[model samples]
Target: MQTEKVVNYIVHWLKDYATQARVNGFVIGISGGIDSAVTSTLCAKTGLDVLCIEMPIHQAESHVTRAQEHIKQLKEKFDTVSDTRSDLTPVFEAFKNEVFFDGDQATVDMALANTRARLRMTTLYYYAGLYKLLVAGTGNKVEDFGVGFYTKYGDGGVDLSPIADLVKSEVYELGDFLKVPESIMNAAPSDGLFGDARSDEDQIGASYPELEWAMKMDEAGKRAEDFTGREQIAFNIYKRFNTANKHKMIPIPICEIPSNLL
Candidate 1:
């Protein structure tokens, strides 16, 4: 399908969700990343009230600057929240200072990353409640649902995700079609929570082209649930979601029946 048609479809679908939910606007975080930039642009074009929150906690100056540039170019209304790292540092420190090593540096980093996500989510939700707006998620198919790159109930939480079905490459293609600024499309995709320590590709270990192929293959039809191939590297991310099964499903409590029931 043409990118314009798809983009229009997504925007209208999101508007329906907002109307059905009785929301006045949408809030999205712009991390100088393509996914968020594309999402913001779509929301702006769709006539939805979009608030682009640039929360640069531990992020580098360049990332924040590029994020602002993208917001400006998109002609979207936005606000900056600085020193956010100070607000979230205590949460990360507490997790690290815990008695057990259940959370190591890597784990701590993940938690810290999630803390940022949750903080942003919380802020969005707060504004959503205040203005009766919905929180529009910027996650693409590869990151949001495929590899489960987002934290449960943190960045993963959203009232509506317009691009959730579009893979990363497709999202970029759509962005190009929409005339999203080159800086946004050219910027390296990152969460900006790790402060240059990691990138989307670095964390996922496969380019979006490869990831989209795997996803399309998985969706089309597969001989086995485990399909190994050149895409194995990308598929490993699927393994992470599988191994962490609890994260995949809600925690269910076992029922204890009394002897009388027998």
Candidate 2:
């Protein structure tokens, strides 16, 4: 896909959505990642007011620095781009101290990480409400649909998802065309949720390229048994992730009654 065309399409889509919804602009959580960087740049390109919030809670210093740099570049390019830095560490610590309970360390850790995402979501909505802006999401196709990698009701909660159809590699392509900072473009992709700074690959057990390939193969009705070595491993990982996170990707299930009864 041509980056320029994709950029133009998303910008126009955002404009149309906001205008029809009677919203002033977009509010996005700038996570210092390529997805957020690309999404924010696209939002700014719409020439509408954009509030890029950097809500850091025990975030990696490198992530924070990259986020600041990206926002600075955005402000320089677009007058409509404005930003706010929110320190959410105290908020997270208070929640942990007051709400967390003893359990499996891994489970507790995952919950805390999710809490961080939810906090960021809340902060975005708070600004959205105050400014009458829609909360723009930054998730891409691979993470959002291929593996359902986002936190449910956390990062997954948003008024709109602009790049949910593009794959991870395609996001990088868009980022390059948008002239996102090289520092962010070259950095490893991390959710910045675990506090230990683990890359998404470290948690997902497969790189974006591998995952993308796996998704393609699966969609084409290829079986893991037909592949060997790393291909097989990638297929297996993809299947496991997609199955485990299907609940997150699919809509809520509801019971239906027979119309005759009514």
Candidate 3:
């Protein structure tokens, strides 16, 4: 995709949405990942008030540092850009100790990670409400739609999704065009939820390039058998994630009564 065209589209989309909603600006959680960096930059380009919040829950120091750097760069370019950091380690620890202390280790680990995401979501909304700003989402197409690799009512909850249509590769392309800091652009994509800082590919069992290809093939009605060995394995993994997380990608199902029963 043409970087300039995509940037222009997102900037105009944000401006138009804010005008329609009569909101003052946007509030986005900066995760130091390419997705957030790109989204924050697009929001800042609108010249409206944009708050880049760093909500870290026992996050890696490197992640925090990169986020700060990105925010600093944003401030240099857009006077409307502002930033604040919220450490959520205490709250997360409390939840784990009070709620999931006796749970299975695997289950507890997953719960704790999800809690971190939800906490960040809460923090973003808190600032959004206080400043009359919309919560801008940073999820991309492959993660948000193809695999549903996001927390429901957590990272998935947002007032606006500026880059939801772009794939992971497309996001990196935009990041390069926007001149995002090399530290952030080059870093492995992680949710920053786990303590060990496992990359998204590590957690998901497939690289983004593989997943993106699988998604495109699936969209074109291709089956796993079309490929052999490793490629098939990747496609199967993609299908499994998509199936398991379908609920996160769609609206809640509702029961309907027959028309004659009205």
Candidate 4:
């Protein structure tokens, strides 16, 4: 892809969309991941007010450091860029106290992790409403469309997605062109929802590159039987996520009323 052209296109798209919507600018959660770094940079290039928020809930040190580094770089590079930090650890703990823990350990843990994402989403939207800024999504093609690896109405909740069309590799290319912090470019991709340093691959059981390959295969109508060994395992992993998380990828289903009934 023409990296420069792609960057310009996204910047223009963002500016145009915000202009049409009459929003002042954008607000995004900075997770220190490649997707957020690239996305925040793209928004900064739009020459509109961009707020980078850090909402951490038991987040790992490395992730926090990288997020801070990236935001600092963005503020230095773009006059319209600004940042704020909100420690959601206490809020998460309070929420856990109010909720029941009747489920198994793994199940409860998963739900709580998703809660972290939802909290951050709420935080971003709060700022967006206060500042009249649009909530900019940081999801990429593989995570947003291919694997559906995001929390519904959580991180998936956004006013617009600037990088959803670009795959992980393509996002990295944009990151390079945008001069994102080196620490982020070298860091492992993660959701940071679990409050640990475990990478996204560790949770999904497949790396971005592997998932990207599997996504292409599935789109080309290839089945698991077509591959063997590691390839088959990766393909199956991709399919399982794509199928289970399909709800996040599509619009919510609605019951249509029959016109005759009225």
Candidate 5:
């Protein structure tokens, strides 16, 4: 697929979303990864005020540097930049003391990562309110609506997602066409939860290509076919769709009669 076509599609999609939401601008938390870079720039192409927040915790020094490069690129192309960060040490420690008494560092890291994502979402909303913009989600098709690699009530929360239909590899393709800095594009995508934690690939045990293949299978209505050796990858994608159930439907009501539904 041509990258320019993808960019045009995203720009048009964002325009439609903006008109529907009655908002003139968009905000994204740029983690210096290919996905966010692509999303932020595509929104900019629509002439929307795209604001990027660099919400890196302690382990994300490299991403912080990358965020600066992303900011420079955004300034050249977009309307504004909101370089923001919140250290999660205090909040992490407090939660650790209260509930994670004997938990390992990995557990602490997971909790902190989710917390960091939630904080960034809150910050995005704060700016959105001030600027009359919507909090744009940077999640890709493989990450957000597909496999659900985001935290609920955190990165998963958003007013709109410009790149939710593109897979991870497609995101990189678009980023390259947009001339997003090569460093951010080349860096292995990470959530910056732990200082040197395993990334999506390591955590999932399947590369992006493999995951994308499974996603295609599911998309083509082939989910029930037996694929025994690939159970892990299937399980990961399955969990993603399962947990993102909230995004797929309305909140659970106390009682819903069939008559009421009709």
Candidate 6:
């Protein structure tokens, strides 16, 4: 891909879309990950006001440090870039106190993790509305389209996605080009939703390069049986996530009444 050209195109696209929508700027959550770093930098390049928010709910220290470093660099490089940190740990604790817990430990833990994401989403939107800024999403192709690794209505909620079309490797390319903080660029990819340093590979059981290959193979109509050994294992892992998370990728189901019934 033409990296410079793509960057210019996305910058122009963001400026044009925001101008057309009559929004002043963009608001995005900074998670200290490559996708967020790349997307936020692109938004900054647009010369529009880009508010980088660090919303942490029981977040790991490494993630928080990287997020702060990236935000600091962005602000130093771009005049239009500004940042604010919102610590939401209390909010999360309060929420847990109010909600009834059910199911096994795993299920309950998963729900809480998702709750953290939703809280961050809500925080972003609150600022977006208060400042008339569009909520910029940081999802990439692999998470947004291939495996649907994001929580629906949580991190998935956004006014625009600047980097959603780019895959994981492409996002890393953009991050490198954008001169993102070295700590962030070198750090392993993680969601940071679990308040721990569990990498995305740990969660998915496959590296991004492997997952990208699987996504391409799946797109090319290659099934798991077509490969054996490691390839098959990776393919099956990809297939399992892609199948289970299909709901997040597709449009919400709607009930359409018959003409006569209407």
lDDT of each: 0.71, 0.94, 0.92, 0.94, 0.74, 0.93
* Per-residue lDDT of candidate 2, residues 65-104 (tens digit): 9999999999999999999989999999988878847889
Per residue, candidate 6 scores C-alpha lDDT tens digits across 1-262 of 8999999999999999999999999999999888899999999999999999999988899998999998988999999999998999999999999999989998999999999999999999999999999999999999999999999999999999998888999988888888988898899999998999999999999999999999999999999889999999999999999999999999999999899997
TM-score, one value per model: 0.80, 0.97, 0.96, 0.98, 0.82, 0.99
Whole-model lDDT for model 6 versus the true structure?
0.93
TM-score-wise, the better of 3 and 4 is 4
How many clashes (backbone atoms < 3 Å, residues ≥3 apart in a chain or on different chains) does model 2 have? 0
Pairs with steric clashes in candidate 2: none
> Would you list the rank order by TM-score, best first?
6, 4, 2, 3, 5, 1
lDDT by residue for model 1 (1-262), tens: 5888998898888778777877766877777888887887787776767777776666777777777787777663333211122244455556557635555689867766777777777777777787677778888877765666777677778887888888888898998998777867877677777777367778767767766776666667643345666566566655555356445344546798999998
TM-score of candidate 3 versus the correct structure, residues matched by position: 0.96
User: In candidate 4, what residue range of length 10 has the lowest lDDT sum?
Assistant: 174-183
* Cα error, candidate 5, residue 45 (Å): 1.7
The clash count for each model shown is 0, 0, 0, 0, 0, 0
lDDT string, candidate 3, 1-262, tens digits: 7889989999999999999999999999998889999999999999899999988887888888899999999999999999988988888878767763666888878877888889989999999999999999999999999999999989999998999999999999999999999999889999998865689999999999999999999999999889999899999999999999999998999999999999
- Summarize candidate 5's per-residue lDDT along 1-262 as a digit string, tens digits: 7888878987998988898888867888887778888888887788867777766556557777887898887787655544555555566567557664358977766777787778778878988898888888888877765566788778888988888878888888888888999898889888766656457777656667777877777667665445656765564556565465546433546765688678
